[model samples]
Target: MATIKDVARVAKVSVGTVSRVLNGSSKISPESYKAVHDAARQLGYRRNAVAQALVSKTSKMFGVLVSDVGVPFFGEMVKGIEEVARQKGLHLLICNGYHDATEEKNMIEYLLSHRCQSLVVHSKGLSDEELIQYSREIPGMIVINRYIDAIKERCVFLNNHQGMHIAVSRLLDSHNGVAYIGSSEDIQDATDRYLGYQKALEDRSIEFNEQWVVHCEPVAEAGYKAIKQLAEQGELPSSIVTYNDALASGVLDYLHGEGIKIPEQVSVVGFDDIELARYLYPKLTTVRYPIREMAEFAANLSIQLLEDATPSVSDEELEFVPKLIERNSAVI
Candidate 1:
């Protein structure tokens, strides 16, 4: 209930002095700082972040936009971002856009309206032009897990094509029959991964067989059903490359139920080596997405972009490569 006026009156200092002290301005004298602190503590005064931002044109807040916070992948990403936030004495205002364009736009506007100068966005719903425009407006804005050619310097993302290609290529080393379980989601990641699968086959001079590939929802049940359909058709491939670990988990379950020995019979490779991949029956061979490291870099870069005129890495240094994690599930 206490205000700046009350603190100033009790501290016996002008309102500007109290304001400077509260705002961490170095111009304030030690005497004024001590007085303001004592008076504010006596009155149990809390600084209003919004009001302070209105005056200072910024705040100690980083706005994060993700598809869904409940998802484990995003949770780890948030953990990384929060780590950096805590180190800098900053707070996070996170919002879920649910992969909806309108919702994504709304969440972004809401963060901006709250005077969030530093923003980290994981937007799969918005167009490149829209995101590029937003990056121009918010100098501290950085895109995560997605890329835009115009704002390549502002993006921290993994190469889905390269990751899938690496997984598929690794499988091709010992197995000729490769299947793909693609995400039905209409995102660039899915498209690039699917393309990566096909490219890997082409580079090996193997004839393409569209029959072994299935596009379904990127979930465990969907992955299970996808493989079931493939099995019912005639036969499954010698090796399978999935959109993500969740799909791979389902594939493992189905294969286990069918008495198919993993690696011995059919090898499986998954993308985004999430924690779940480690605990699976035969473990999992996966591409490490490195989301945690990517997120930490993004949050740190957001701060740098806000504070420094030069920023860091003016080129395409934001791109991250995925490392293939070989576990028990895949052979050779």
Candidate 2:
């Protein structure tokens, strides 16, 4: 109910002086600042964020778009972005695209309509051309988990190929029969990871078989179904590489129900070192995606691009390599 004018009257100072103190402008005297603060506290006065944004022509807010907020993967990414945004005195406006192209475009447009100057996007459905146009339109937009050559400087992504390669290589070292359980999504990540698995097989002179590969939704239930399908065909491999930790956990559950011992009869390696991976029976061995670090970097870069005329992107920050985490699930 209290306004700046009320605070000014209570403090016995001019409204301009109160404004300067509230804005933290160095031009105001300390006495005026103290008096304004004391009066504001006594009157329970709060600064208007929308009014401040209108005056500055920029909101003190950051926007983020992820595939699914309910998933732990996106949850971690959001946490990282929130951490950096809070430190910079900004709040987050989050949207979920649900891996749909139209939904992604709509969500992005909604964020822009809100006058959010800084944005971090994780898009799997939009084409490179569409994303490129968006990057040009929004100078502070940063892409995560995907690479576009036209906006290479604004992309923060992991090396999906290398991550899969390392996972497959680990399995090939000890197991003669290896299978790959991958996501059915038509995203670049799914393609790149499958290619990495194939390349690893070629490097070891192991023949590639289509039957050894299965594609399904990137979730625990789909993983369980895929493993069951493999078993029905009597083509289950001695070792398996999964698209992510959730799928891998499903595979473990299915194997346990079937009375198959992990790392004894079959070994499994997963991508994304999510927290659940460590707590699973026999602990899943996985590749660390470093999503939290990447999300924080993307949020920072988005803010920098908005504040600076020329923003710089380091190679190390743009291309993050996945690290292999050894655990009790796999052998050799």
Q: Candidate 2 on 1-332: residue-level lDDT in tens?
A: 78889999999999999988877799988889899999998996766443344468768778899999999999999999999999999889999998899999988877875667788999998889989988876778899999998889999999999999998988888989688999999899999999999999999999998887899999999999999899898857899999999999999999999999898999999999988899999999999999999999999998888778468667776999999999999995
TM per prediction = 0.83, 0.82
Q: How many backbone clashes does candidate 2 have?
A: 0
Would you list the C-alpha lDDT of every candidate in the order shown? 0.89, 0.89
Clashing pairs in 1: none
* Per-residue error (Å), model 1, residue 223: 0.6
Model 1 bad stretches (over 4 Å): 1-58, 314-316
What lDDT does model 1 reach? 0.89
Q: Tell me the lDDT of model 1 at 282.
A: 97
Name the lDDT value of residue 238 in candidate 2.
90
